[model samples]
Target: MLHFLPAPLRGLIGATLLALNTLACCVPLFSVTLLKICLPFPAAQRLCRWLMDFIHEAWISCNKVWMNLLGNTQWQVEGLQGLDYQHSYLVTSNHQSWVDILVLQYLLNRRVRPLKFFLKQELIWVPVIGLCWWALGFPFMKRYSKAYLAKHPEKKGKDLQTTRRTCAKFSQTSVGIFNFLEGTRHTPAKHAAQQSPFKHLLKPKAGGIAFVLDAMGEQLHSIVNVTIHYPQGNPGFWDILSGNVDEVVVRFKELPIPAEFIGRNYDQDEAYRLQFQQWVNQLWLEKDAELSELKQRFPGH
Candidate 1:
C-alpha cells in the first residue's frame, strides 16, 4: 500500500510512525534511566538494566515492524547459525549509511546479546537518546588526535584508561560490542580521496578495535565479522523509509580472537600492532571480494 503512494506521502507516514514509536519508547526508557542513575546499589542497578533491556528490545521490535510496513527491501542474511545469546561478542561491520544500524538491529535482535556501540564521548549529551545509550552501557570514548596529544603529553593514555574502566562493567553480563571499522560512511568521493586499497571499502582503522581487544579481550567469546551490501545502491534513511531501497545483503562470519592478540599493547608494541593491522587488512580484503561477488549476483535493483 505504501508503494503506491507518492514518495513524499510515504515518507511522511513512515517517518511519523517511526517518530511515534521512538517517542513512546524514549519516555519509559528515560524514566528508567533516571532511576538507574539515582540508584547506586549494585542489585538495584542490575534490576534497572534488566528493565531497560526489555524496553530497548521492544523498541527494536517496533522499529522492525515499521520497516516491514513501510519498506519493500529484500533481505538476504546468512551465517547466524550456532550463535549463543549468553556469550559476549565483538561485532565489526563496514559502514555505508545510517540504515545499517537498523538493519543490524533487525537481524541480530535476539540472535545474540544486546548490541552496545562504542559511541563518541560527546554523544552522551544529545538529549534523551544519549542518556538511553548511557543507561544501556554503551562505552563512550574520548579519543585524542595525534596532534592534540602532541600538545598535551600528560593526557596521552587517558582514553585507554577510560576504555579499560568502562569495559570492566561488561564482564558482569553478555553483550555484543559493535565497531564500524571504516570509521565513517562510504561515499564515492571519499573513497577516491582515500585512495583506498580495497575496491569497495575504505582503509580499516585498527586502533579502535585494537583498544577494545586490549580492554575486553579475555571476556569476548568470538569476533563476528558482518558484511552488509546494498544491492540497490546505498540508500539514505529517508530513501529506506520511503521504500526506495529494494534489497540488502548481510553476511556474518564468526572467528576466534587469536590468543596472541588478546591483552596485547596495540599502541606501544610495534610488532603486535603490525600483526593486528595485517589481520584486519586481510579481513577487509575478503570483505571487498565478497562485495564484488554480491554485486555480480545482484547486478541491478
Candidate 2:
C-alpha cells in the first residue's frame, strides 16, 4: 500500500482520511441528538435505533473506503450462523487493540444491534464520540475505589445500583453488550505490570461482568464468546491500513444462559461468585492456548 508514495506522504494521507471520517460521523450524531429532544419517548427510542444502525453503516463504509484507498486488503469474516437478531447476547472477548472494536463491528453489524459497551463515566466527556455513545444508549458507569467506599459506607453499592437501573432500562429489542474481560488492551509492559496469570491476557475482571449479569440476567438469552487471533501479533491502525497485518481468525461460540445463574447475588454470595470466576478463567485459558498455536503457525505474519 502506497509502496509508490513516500512514507511521509502516506502518513499525511492517512491523517487526512481520519479527519474526513470524523467529520462525516458528526452528521448523524447531531441529527440523533436533535431528534431525541424533539420526539416523544417511544418515538425517540425508535429513532435512536435507526440512528445507531445508520452510524454503524457509515462506520463500515469508512473502514472499506480507507482500506481501499490505501490498498486492496482482503477482509475475512466467519462463524456467523443461526445468530438470532431478536435475542439479547452478552459478547465477551479478549482485548488487544482499538482495531478489535472495528473487527467486531464489521462482523456483527447486521447480525445484531450495534454493541452497547459499558463505559467509564469519564468517557462521557470525550469530544464527539462520547456524545454519540450516550445518544446510542451506552451506559456510562462509575466504579468506586475501595478507599472511597471505606470512607463513605453509604456510597458502597450506589454505583452498581445505578448501573443496574440504567442497564435495566436499556431497550431490549435485540442487542449485544461487549465486554473486554481483560479490562484494557494488551501490551507487554501492562501485562508485566499486572503480573497476569495467563500468557495471552491480563487477569479477568469479574466485577464488570458481575455487574452486567446481575443487571440484565433475565433478559440475556446467550453469550457470544468470541476468540480473536491476529496471527502475527496485535497490529496498530496503520499496520492494518498499510497491509502489514495478516490474518485475523475469529471463532464464535454461543453459550446458553444457565437457569441457575439468572438474578443470582453477585456480591453477597461468595460461593456463587467463586464459581463464576472459575468459569471465566477457564475461558481465558483456552483462548490463550489457541492464540499461542496460531502465533506459532504464522510466525512471520
Question: lDDT (0-100) at residue 44 of candidate 2?
Answer: 78
- Residues forming the 10-long window of minimal summed lDDT in candidate 2: 70-79
lDDT of 2 by residue, 254-274 (tens): 888767677777878899899
- Over 4 Å off, model 2: 1-8, 71-77, 241-243
Looking at model 1, residue 247 earns an lDDT score of: 88
Report the Cα lDDT for residue 47, model 1: 85
Instruction: State every prediction's TM-score relative to the real structure.
Output: 0.95, 0.88
| Candidate 2 residue-wise lDDT at 232 | 61
Candidate lDDT scores, in order, read 0.87, 0.76
**What is candidate 1's local distance difference test score?**
0.87
In candidate 1, residue 163 scores what lDDT? 77
Q: Which parts of model 1 are misplaced by more than 4 Å? A: none
In candidate 2 the C-alpha lDDT for residue 21 amounts to 86
Give every collision pair in model 2: none
